[model samples]
Target chain A: MSYNKRNDGRAFDELRPMDAKVGIIKNALGSAMFRIGKTVALAAVYGPSELFPKFLQKKEEGLLRCTYNMMAFSGSGTRVKPGPSRRSREIELVTRNALESVLDLSECPRAVINVNIELIQTDAGTRCAGICAASMALADAGFKMKDLVAAVSAGLVGDKIVLDLDYSEESFEEGAVDIPMAFMPRTGKIALLQLDGEITKEQLREAIKLAKKGCKQICEVQRQALKEKYKTEE
Target chain B: MGILIEDKQIVVPGEEVAEGMDFLPAPGTFRDGDKIVACQLGLVNISGRLIKVIPLEGAYMPKRGDVVIGKINDLTYSNWFVDIGYAYEAALSMKEATTEFIERGAELTDYYTYDDVIVAKITNVTKSKSIDLSMIGPGLRKLQGGRLLEISAQKVPRVVGKQGSMISMIKEITNCQIIVGQNGRVWISGTEIWQERLASEAVLLIARKAHTHGLTDRVKAFLESGSKK
Candidate 1:
C-alpha cells in the first residue's frame, strides 16, 4: 500500500490533538468537553440523585444510564436529525458500559446517575470521544471511581495501523477496519471493544496494543482536566 | 504487593496503588488480581497492613454504626422515613425509635413531626440498600431549637478530631451546645444567635480547610478573632 502518510500528516501510530475541560456545565453535578482532532463531545452527569420508577431499582448498587446524541449541525452538510437513531442507541449502551466499569456505583445505592454525551462535532472517533468525556464528567461529579478510563480508535489502513483516524481515513479505501477500544488505566482492563471492519488475527493483536497505549495518553489528558477542576488551595 | 505510591500521595482515578499480595486494599481502593488500585482522587493513607484512600471530595454515604442527623420525611405504619441527604431514605422503626410501646392507632406525628431533625444511629444497612435507624442509644433524640449546619461528611473526622478534642474545643470556645452528626450535620445552640453563627463559621473554617495541619490552633484563633469583633 503506497501512502503519503496520514491526511493530518501524523504517523501510522500517532494520535490527533487532544484537549479536555471539566465542569463546563455549571448546573451539572459533573460536566466535561473533550476534543480529539475535529471530533468534539460534551458530556454531563446528573443525579446520583434518585432512581425513578421504583420497581427497577437495584438493591445493591446505583443505576447508571447514558444518553449518546449527535447534534444536527455536527456533521458536514445535510443536517442529521437530532434524535436517537439506532446508531446513537448502540453507542449509548456501550458508553454506559465503558463508564460503569470504572465508577464505584455501589457506593450510592438506590440512586441513579445519568450520564449524557452530545457529539457537537464529528470527525471519525465520536464514540471514543464520547466515552472519554462522560467518564471525566462522572469523576468531576465527586463520584469515587475505581480509576479514570479513556478510549481511542485505531484502524487498519491497507496494511498500515493508524491511530485516531479522521473521517477521511475512516471511510477511505477498501478493507480499512475501525477498532475502537475503551480501557481502564488503573487495572489495565478493556471495558468496551468494537470492530467496525474486518481484519486478520495478527492485525487485531497489534491494533489492541497500539490502541491501549494511545488510551493511556488520552487518560493523562483526562487526569489533567480533573486535577485542574478539583484543585484546592493547599 | 509493594505499594506503588507513597503515603499521603495524591492519586487520581485509575492510578495503581500497590502491586503484590504484600499490601491490602482498604476503603477507597479496590483490588485487581494482586494489584491494589486507587479508584478516587485523594490522599493515600497506608495504615498498618492496609492501604486507605481518603477521598478529598466526600459526598456523604451512610455506613453502619454511623451517628447521623436525619429529618422525618414521612411516617409509615411502623416506621418513620428519614431523609439523610442522599437518595436512599432510611427507615426508623417505631420499635427501635423508642423503647416505649403505645397502643395501636396512635398518631405518628405526635412523636416526631414532619421535618423534625433527629440525631440517631444507623443500626443496620441491609443488602437491598434499606437503612435501619435507632434512636434508643445514648445522646440520641429529637433535636429542637438549634441552628443546623452542614459540612462534607469526609470532613467530619477532622472536625471531631482525636478523642473529641476538636469538637470540644469549639464548644468550649464558642460556649455553645454542639452536636455533630456523622452525616456532616451540626446542631449548634448558643444563648445568642450571633454566638451560634460565630460557632458555625468556626466549624465552616475547619470544613473548608480541613486538609491543613494544626487546624485546632487555627480554629481557636479564628473563634477568638470573631468573638472580639
Candidate 2:
C-alpha cells in the first residue's frame, strides 16, 4: 500500500505530539479528552451504583464495564461503522481489563462503574489512545484506584523501531508489528498486552524492551495531562 | 530459527525483560525475529513463559466485596432499581432491604420513594451484567436530609484514599456524617447547619484537586479556613 511520511521526520520509535484534557464532560461523573498526534479519544466514567443481574454479583465489590466507539469522522479516508461492531467489543474488553487492574473495586460495594471511550480520530494507535483516555476519565470520575495507567503503541518498521505508530506506518509493509500495552509506572505492573504482526522470538525480546521505554515516555505525557487538568480547576 | 536472526525474540534497546527468560514471538505479529520497538514507556512483565507490558494511568472499576453508596431511581413490587452507571440498572430486592415492617401494597412508595439515595451492598451480579444489591448490613442506611455533591467515579478513590483516611478526616473535622454514593453522589449532614456546608466545600475541593499529591494537608487547611469563615 502507498504511504505518506509524517511531517516532523521522527525516528521509527518516536511518538507524535500528544495532549490530554480531563473533567471536560459536564454530564459524566468523570470525563477526559486525549490526543496522540492526530488520533484522539474521549472517555467518560459513570456508576458504582446498583448492578443489573443475570450474572453473579459481588455484594462486596463493584463491577467494571467499558464501551469503545469510533466516530464516523474518526478515520481519514473511509468512515467507520456508526454502531458497535465486533472490533469495538474487543477494544472494550481490552480497555476494561487494563483499567480494572488499577482500580480499587473493593472500596465501593454493590455498584457498577461504566466507562465510554469515543474515538475522535483514527490514527494508527486508537486502542492505545483509548487506554489513555479512559484512564483520565476514570480519574475524572473520582473512582478509587491504586494508580494511574498510561498506554502507547510501538512497532518495528524496517531496521528502526518506532514509537506511537501512525496510520500510514501501521499498515505499510516495511515489515512492522504493533504492540499496545498499559502499566502502573509506580508499581511497575502490567495491565494490558496485545500484539499484531511478525517478529521472531529474539525480536520479541527487543520489541518488549523498546515498548517499555516508550511507556515511560507516555507516562510523562499522562502526568502532564493530569497536571493540566488539575491546574484548570485551580 | 537461527537461520537469520538467531534467538527469534526481538528485545528493544532500553527495554527490560525478566531475568533468565528468553523473549518469544508476539502471538500473531512476529516474523522469526523482526524487531519491535517500545510503544509507550512502561514496565515489562515476564511471568512464566508470557511477556506483557502495562501502562500507568486510568480509572477504577467496582469488584466483588466493595462497599459503595447509591441513589434510588425507581422501585417495583419485587425490587428497587438503581442507576449504578452500568449498562443496566442494579436491583435491590424487598427481601434484602430491611426486616422492619415495610407496607406490602401501595404504601411502598411512601417508604423508599424515588430519588432517595442510599448506601447498600452488592450481593450478586449476573453473567448478562446485572447487579443485585442489599441494604441489610451494618453502616447501610437510607441517605436523606443533606446536600448531595457528585464527583468522578475514578476520583472516588483519591477522595477516599488508603483505608478511609481521607473520608474519616472529612467526617471528624467537619463533624458530619458523610455518605458517599458509589455512583458519584455524596450526601453530607451535620448536627449544626454550617458544619454540613463546610463538609460539602471540603469534599468539592478534594474532588477538584484530586490529581495533585498530598491532598490531605490541603483539604485540612481548606476545612479549617472555611470553618473559621
Candidate 3:
C-alpha cells in the first residue's frame, strides 16, 4: 500500500523542528548542540594544536579529524555500545569529508583540528544531525571557512517522498529509501550524499530537490546559532 | 559601493561583510569574487577603505615580538622547550635564556628548570609554526611565587586596556605586580595573598566583559568597591 500521510503528521515536503545552539561546551574551543525531531547531537571542536603520533601530521594543511559516537542509551531500538563501532567510524569519516572542503587550514600546518560528535538521543538521521552540529561547532571555533554545511535526510517512504525521516518513517512497513545529503548553502555545492535502499531516478532527483530546500532552512538555523554566541547583551 | 554589514556587527564565517570592490578585505576576512566575506566569527571593523573582522575567539596564533609567559616543559642539551599556549612548543636556547655566557656543557636547569614559568619574548616564528623565544629583554625573568591565571588570548588587549591603563590601575589598587602575556597567561604576585587575588579578579573581569561598552569605568568601579571591602 502507498503511504498517504506522514507518520508524524508532517507534510511530505516539511522537515522536523530544528533547534541549534553554539558555545555549549565551556572547555572546548568551540561547541554546538543540534536537535532535529528526537535526534540530539552535540559537537565539540578542540585544537589546531599539535598532532601526536607525528606521522599523521600534514605539512601543507591541518588535519580535520572527526569522531562520531552514540551514548549507551541513545538508540531508539537498542542500547548502543560505548566505544567506536564500524557504523560510527563510517559516520566519522563522512563527517570529516563533509566539513573539510570549506576549511582553510593551511596557516596551521602540522596541526590537527579535532571535532568530536556525540549523539545524546537518536531517532533517525543521526549522521546528518551530527554533521550539522559539527559544522556549527567548526564555525564557532573561528576557523577560516568558505561556508557552513547543512545536512538533512530525504527519502522515499513507500511511494511518497518525505523530508527528515524520523524513526517511524524510516521503519515504514513498506520499504523506505533513505538518502542523507549535505550541502554548502552559499555555493550550492554538495558536500555529502549517501543513499540506502532503492528508488527510481526520477524519484531520486525529486528527493534531492526537496532535501536542498530543507538544507537551506538548516543553514539559516546554523548561522543564527553562531551569531547568537557573540550577540551583545541588551 | 555598499557594505552589507554595519561596523561592529558580529559576523559569521562565509557571511558577506561588503558587496563592493571599494572595500579592501583585511585579516579575518577574505575577498570572494567581488564580495568581502568574513572567514571568522568576529565583529566587523571598518576603517577607511579596509574592512576586517576582529575574531571573538580561537587558539592563540603566535606572532613575533609578543611578550609571552611560558612554562618550561622539556629540556635538551642546548634548549628548553617552553609551552606558550600555542599549537607548538617554542625553543628557548641558552644564548637567549641569559645575557651571561658560560661553558657549552653547562646544566640548562640552573637558569630555568622543569615547570618553571617565565616571562619571555617571541623572537621568531617559522612558516612551519616552529617558535623561538628569548628571555634577554628587560622585565623578562622567571616568575616566582605568583599565581597564574589563564584567559582567552583574544581578551589580552582588554586586560591590558588602552596604553596599559587598565592593568596599571589594577596593579596600583591591589598593590600587586601583574604581567599579562600575549598568550593570555597572567602572572600576579603581591605582598599579601588577598591583594594577588584581587588583581586576578580584576583581570578576569576585564577578560570576561571585553566586548561590552564602558568596560574601563566598570572595572574601575569594581576595583574601588573591592578595595573598600
Candidate 4:
C-alpha cells in the first residue's frame, strides 16, 4: 500500500511548526525552550566548572555531559518513568556526542559542561527537539562552538518520505521508518544519524536530503532565539 | 571582501564575521577557510584590520593580579582554601595571608575561619588550574559588615567604568564603600542600610544595561534620582 498523504496534512517536505526561545531559566548559565508540534524540550547549560571524580577529568579538553529526561506525564501514549531509564541513557549519550562536535573546550581543561534536557511534552520527535534546544542553550551560555547543531526526523510512513514525523505518523498502521538526524548547517556535517527501521538505499538518501533541508530551517530558528535574548531596546 | 557584521552588532557561533583575508581573526573568532567566523555569542568588535568578538557572558577564568572576593571554605595548618568563584579553590598560605608574619601551626580560623568573606589578589594560576591568592595587598582584607551582591563577571569592567569614574561616582553619591571583585562578587558597606541597598541596586542596574549605550549618564541620573527617592 502507498501512503499519499501525511496524517497531519503537512506536505512531504514540510516540518511541524516550531517555536523556540532562549534565556528561559535565569539561574542556569544558559537556557532555552524548543517546541516542535506537540513535543516541548527545555534545555539548561551549567558549568565548564569543576569536574568531579577526578578520573573522568580530561587534561586536554573539557567534557560535555548531557542528560535527557521525560516528565511522568509527557508521553502521548502512557506515563513516562520519573527517573533515568535505559532509553534515556542512550539518548543522553547520543545527545552529548551530537553537541560535542561543535564545542571548543580546550580552554576549560579539567572542567565539564553539562547540558540538561527535559522533555515537558513528547509527540515523537523528543530527541530532535532536545538537541535543538540544547544547541541554543550552549550558544546562549557563550560557549565557543564551531557551529550550531539542528536536528529533525525524516523517514517513510508506509512508502512516502516525510519530514518531521508526528505521533500519528510514527504509529501508522503501515510500516514506518523513523530516521532522526542532526546536522551542522554551515559545514553540512552530520552530527547525528539514527534509523529505526529499514528502507531502500535510494529512499534513505532522499530522506536524508529532506532532513538536511529541515535542519537548515531549524538552524535559522535557533539563531533567532539566541539573538532575541540580547536584543537591545529601541 | 568585507566585514559582514557591523561593529557592536551581536553574532553567534559559526556566523561569518568577515568574508575576506583582509580581516585578521582575533580571540573569540577563528579563520574558517577564507572566512572569519565567530566562535562565541558576542558583540562583533572591529578595529582597523582586526576582527574580534567580545563575549557577553561566561564563567570567570581566574587571571593573575586580579583582585577578587572569596569566602573561606576550608583551612589547613598553613593554608586556607578560598572559593573565588572559579572551578578550582584558591590557596592562601599563611605567608601571603597578611602583612604580619603568621607563625607555623598557628590557629588558622582565628585569622580566617570558614565562610569568612575576604578580598584578596590572585598571585598565580598554574596550568593545572590551581590558583594562589594573596591577602597582603592594599584593599585586601576580611569584609566586616556589608551586603554582598553577585553580578556577571563579564560586566565587572563596565561597573568599574573607564579609570574608576563610574564606581567613584557611585561611592560619592551613595556614601558607601564599594569593592567589586573581578570574579563578579561585590561588597558594599554604608553607614545607613538604605545607602547600601541603593548602591547595590545601581550596580545591578549597570550590569543589566552594560551592553546599552549612554550607560554612564543613565547611571548618574539613576543614582541622583535614587538618592532623592
Which model scores highest in lDDT? 4
Residue-level lDDT tens digits of model 1 in A1-234: 545578778888888999999879976767899999889999998876778799877877889999988898899743357888888889888988888787778777778888989989998798999999998888777687877879999888776888888888877776678999998875779999999888889989999999999998999999888776545545
Question: How does residue A65 of candidate 3 score in lDDT?
Answer: 93
Q: What tens-digit string does per-residue lDDT give for candidate 4 at B50-125?
A: 9999888888888999999999999887799999987778999888998876676667788999999999999998
Compare the candidates by TM-score and give the number of the best one.
4
Clashing residue pairs found in predicted model 4: none
Question: Interface RMSD of every candidate?
Answer: 2.3, 11.7, 1.4, 1.4
- Cα error of candidate 3 at position B197, Å: 1.6
**Candidate 3 stretches greater than 4 Å from native:** A232-234
True contacts kept of each: 0.58, 0.08, 0.76, 0.68
What DockQ would candidate 2 receive versus the native complex?
Answer: 0.08
Ten consecutive residues with minimal summed lDDT in candidate 2 chain A? A1-10
Scored on chain A only, each candidate's TM-score is 0.94, 0.90, 0.97, 0.97
TM-score of each: 0.85, 0.58, 0.97, 0.97
After superposition, the stretches of candidate 2 with alpha carbons farther than 4 Å from their true spots are A1-8, A77-79, B1-229
TM-score of 3: 0.97
C-alpha lDDT of residue A200 in model 4? 97
Best candidate according to DockQ: 3
Kindly report which residue pairs in candidate 1 clash with one another. A146-B39, A147-B13, A147-B14, A148-B13, B1-B20, B1-B21, B1-B22, B1-B23
lDDT of 1 at B207: 84
